[model samples]
Target: MPTLKTLQPGDEPLLEAFLWQHADTSMFLRSNCRAAGLLDEGARFQGTYVAAYINEAIVAVAAHFWNGMVIVQAPVHLAEVVQAAVTQSGRAIAGISGPAAQVEATKSVLGLSNRPTQLDESEILFSLTLADLQIPPALGAKQVQCRFPHSDELELLCEWCAAYNIEALGQKETSSLQPACRQIIEARQATSVHWVLVAENTLVSYSAFNAALPDIVQIGGVWTPPALRGKGYAKCVVAGSLLEARSHGVKRAILFTSDDKQAAQAVYRGIGFVPTGEKYGLVLFEG
Candidate 1:
């Protein structure tokens, strides 16, 4: 049995190298490590990182983040190792996200199966290589311009983000999301941007690179107003964002969406994204 051990400073590189092998599933873990390192500094993205190793090689990695998200990328059998790490850290875990099977196993080990959760879902993972990207006629003909949200559009974006939370994350309150939406709009990510699609001077679609590294990006927060959807705007915003990331040397993009949303899936496929045959878990607990 591989014993779980809390990681210290300087262990990041080893963990990173291991995670890179499973980049599609480890994007969140990798991005968080780069942003917060091994220690919990009580800052956004900081978390307690742990590992199970064999002969100086990291076999699996898990983290319980400050925001109460426990993200892991490990073999299903190693779920116990992940739960042990979370327990040792004594960090509150309001949610668990990871590979689908692994999360199910971890949830069982952590005895959270019966706990009421605000969100417990497994989303299909999609991957796209930027070289194969297809730019839609909407963008190619300039019918809609896909660009980063402007500072002056904060209120509009905030409303969109709130609606997105309600729809995507099962968040029930719109009034409570303003503070978080403000942080997102005001954030200046050196490696990321939230993109918006505009046609006739109206913002019609929105998306963002939630986790980004130089080589890869994970697309998230894709939202279009109900009245504005079904017009291929979602594809434009995502594809346009990927184009910008590709310009800066990002080679690939990934996203997770529910299986029931055929339209959303088709929109992604239309832009050249293919299912990666993997599942992503996004289980969130109510506060």
Candidate 2:
């Protein structure tokens, strides 16, 4: 039987090494640890980490974050580790995310499989090495400028975020998502993680690195307004933002999108992203 326990302060090196083996599916867990460590410090990125071990080596890891979300990267002994994650943390799970099969197993163990949620999805994971990134013709030709959003653009960015939450995720309650959208835009305002594509002095699209590490980034919150859809601006902003990230030493990028979104998937493929043969789950409860 595997031993399951909560992670401690000094377990960083081993935990990180184990997580790196599952990097694409472990972004939330690894990024949160990098930002806030194992202790649930009552901060944005802090969480109570749990690990399952076999013969003293970690075989799986999970965390129940301060925001009431659970993310796991359990490759073995799924039910035991997931159940321990919830029982040890004693936190109400507002949602859960991770590898598709793991998330389902987690919800099953936690009795959340039947719970109603605003969004529940299993999306195909895609990734690219920045060196293979293909710049959109319009971006390379300077037909559109890619730049970070201005501090004054918070409200606009938030609005676009809300739209993204609705259209992409199938979440209906915009009001419930507004505060989070605003907070993210405000918090990341001074960072290069968020990028906007402007044409003729007007914003046409938005793309952001929702999760970041020294060498890898996960793209999310991509939105081109309804009026701007079907014009290839989506690919432009993504490729342009990635080019900038590459210039600054980021070596790779990953993202997950619904399988029904064939057009969007094709756009990403056109810019050198290929399916990583992994699936990620996302579930957000309605408040």
The estimated TM-scores of all candidates read 0.95, 0.95
Best by lDDT: 2
Find the 10 residues in a row with the least total lDDT in model 1.
Answer: 184-193
Candidate 2 TM-score, true structure as reference: 0.95
Error of 2 at 23 (Å): 1.2
- Give me the overall lDDT of model 2: 0.88
lDDT on C-alpha atoms for all candidate structures: 0.85, 0.88
RMSD of 2: 1.4
| Candidate 1: pairs in clash | none
Q: Which lDDT tens digits does candidate 2 get at residues 137-212?
A: 9999999999998877779999998888888766776556899888888767755689999999999999998788
Measured by TM-score, the strongest candidate is 2
